[model samples]
Target chain A: MKPAHRKIEAPRVTVDIVIFTIEEAKLKTLLIKRKFDPFKNIWALPGGFVRSKEDIYAAALRELSEESGISGVYLEQLYTFGSPKRDPRGRVITIAYFALASRQKLRIRSASDAKDAGLFSVDDLPRLAFDHKEILEKALERLGNKIQYTNVLWSLLPEYFTLGDIQRVYEIIWGKKADKRNFRKKLLSLGLLKPIGKLRKGLRRRPARLYQFKTKKYVELKRFF
Target chain B: MKPAHRKIEAPRVTVDIVIFTIEEAKLKTLLIKRKFDPFKNIWALPGGFVRSKEDIYAAALRELSEESGISGVYLEQLYTFGSPKRDPRGRVITIAYFALASRQKLRIRSASDAKDAGLFSVDDLPRLAFDHKEILEKALERLGNKIQYTNVLWSLLPEYFTLGDIQRVYEIIWGKKADKRNFRKKLLSLGLLKPIGKLRKGLRRRPARLYQFKTKKYVELKRFF
Candidate 1:
């Protein structure tokens, strides 16, 4: 009876991180091939079981680090997937996190936990295991909608960036050409960007000005969305 | 050896509905007291196991009917909770759905599945089992934010309601007073409301006019948010 009770007490939970970075003018996500059973060798989001002491966010960051050797990125809870059949192995509940980093900044040294790891464009991802395709769709929608109302785009930006660079990221993620004038006008109206007295030098076009984040505005307008 | 290779399977999934209906100018949620062990006698969201044949949304709707006497309402997925220790007895993955209905339309009758069922104001909710409180918060935030952008407010309105009535619901959910003039202007800009040839009779002074929803706008502008 005690053994049966113990068996009933255990619950399986995992964390999956949807790491988005802009590469080759496209929004890409880090995915890995599972080497074990339950969709073995199939590509899936970098994820793993949560440890006893950590919270949901910590587990996602840990799994992300373990799979791709990346850490300390801005990670937010995307959503949780608890459909009983979402996991082919047992009753596994998976919490998904969305991590944003610049494409140029991401440095992955190893795909240790996964059979292999690589970045795939969000628009044309390979077949993923489980209900990950649905999960990815939801994450993309959430991220796109969030950037419209919240300053969530900042995490995907560098400390100093050109307006065109920001516009390109939005175009890549939103899947449309944003009215450049209106996009710049609306974001600047929010008073969250500050010019840093620097300009880009090597482009064939006009030299673009660089700006840094006004961190105070983000905290002050935390509930803007 | 062949028998040892048990095919991996997803655990039995369940969807819980947190239906909110406004009554007497208060935000309330439908709660049911559990009659079985593992948080027995605890107040919880009305829910049940998802059947093998039905989808998650269907399961949530069915559970809403079983636990409470309410049916055929506006429901949307809020979030899913799958922490390993969220359930004390076993690994039961629950997908949460938030349902909206006019408070006056809610009819709660005693049911066999739940020990008790009733609408409780969000501010004064009793001790609930599982991580339902967290789910409740997420649902509330989703509703609040959704109303600001979408015409989802129609779900809480009667066939015809005054601008003030709808605005009050907004204030109650957002916990802030919106400038009445600004509020009305924004709603009017949405062009989703139609002036019906009717007047409200309960006013002490001049009677207020009633407005009906423009159904076509609901579809044409479904992606407004």
Candidate 2:
């Protein structure tokens, strides 16, 4: 039975991060293979226990760095999962966060309680440890809804890319294709991107003009799809 | 010194809620005078610690109901504030939540851990206890940003209202007046509101048509200010 509402209880707190990026036109997340027991050898979000004297966000960044050797990504607090039975060890709560990393910043060096780490396409993920699968679903929903009116998707793209490149990123996350003509016209009208006056010349067909966001920082759009 | 990263520690967890409603065309939040020590005689957001076995959301709703006697309002997980020094009693971390209660459904019968309860305008609030002031500020920012692109503002207004009535709610929350012409035109273009086909008849001047949102539930707008 649960304690009375007035009775004070301290549940263990931890931080978990769902680091996301775009690769091969599919959404991918960084997962670390756990090295120790409870769920040994199972892949889970890169995270660890929040230290006694640390902020939750700082804990997320530190764990991401320690477990996967990835840092400085644009991370935001996604949600807090505090189901008392979530952890087998005891009553534990986790502060879940989501991060966006561009492909250029992708690197990994699994260590410190992590047996191995790699990016797995969100479409085909291994059985995750704890309630991480639920956490990933929430992160994906947030990412999908946000990219409609926020510039977060640009964080997964190169600094300069063709219009088609950006549209493909959106489609990959949405898991469906957008009408090419309407998407290009509507996306261009948002004025979120600016032409670089330079074109890509390596393509077999005509060189395509490159464009980049006016500001790389993720911000909400006044109007969007 | 603090224990190593692998050392498991249980930190006290609490749930705090910022209950917001619009009154007199000003954004207001429910505050309760603390009934017990640590912050007694001081007003704080309605909240309490989570029980040994309960979900965080259930804790939030239970706390709100126990103190304010308001329930069935729209509540969402805002953010978690877990700074080690936040609580004076011990190392307590709070999972904060925010709620939207319509003025009609709001009724206060302060009980449980509340000494008194009242509505205070967000623009001019009394000094709050604990880290509640900071939590309220975060809630207000989330509310401000959300209303721009979501139909949440309707939750604070009457079911049948004039176009001007809805615009005033926006202006009040935004803390500034919007261009009437553009606000009305742009708002109508969204096709969110439907005319009730009846006019309000209590005024001395011409009776204006009453309008209600097509749906009362909060929904995201495809395009908004």
DockQ of each: 0.20, 0.39
Q: Which CAPRI quality tier does the interface of model 1 achieve?
A: incorrect
Q: How accurate is candidate 2 locally (lDDT)?
A: 0.85
TM-score winner: 2
Pairs in steric clash, model 1: B22-B103
Could you give candidate 1's per-residue lDDT for residues A1-225 as a string of tens digits? 111132222335678888888889989988888887678899998887665544556677777777666665677787766565677554566778888877666776446557888899987889999988988888898787777667767777777999898889888887889788998987788788899999988989899999988782223243332
- lDDT by residue for model 2 (A1-225), tens: 122234565678989999999887778999999998779999999887888778888898887777656666688899999987788876789999999888778777787788899999999999999999999999999998888778887878878999988889888988899999999999888878899999999879999899988987778775467
Query: Pick by lDDT: which candidate is best?
Result: 2
Q: Cα miss at A201, model 1 (Å)?
A: 5.2
Instruction: Report the CAPRI category for model 2.
Output: acceptable
Which residue segments of model 1 deviate by more than 4 Å? Answer: A1-14, A34-42, A48-56, A80-94, A109-113, A175-211, A214-225, B1-14, B36-42, B48-54, B83-93, B111-114, B176-189, B200-208, B216-225
lDDT (C-alpha, whole model) for all candidates:
0.75, 0.85
- Alpha carbon deviation, residue A182, candidate 2 (Å): 7.6
Every prediction: chain A TM-score: 0.88, 0.91
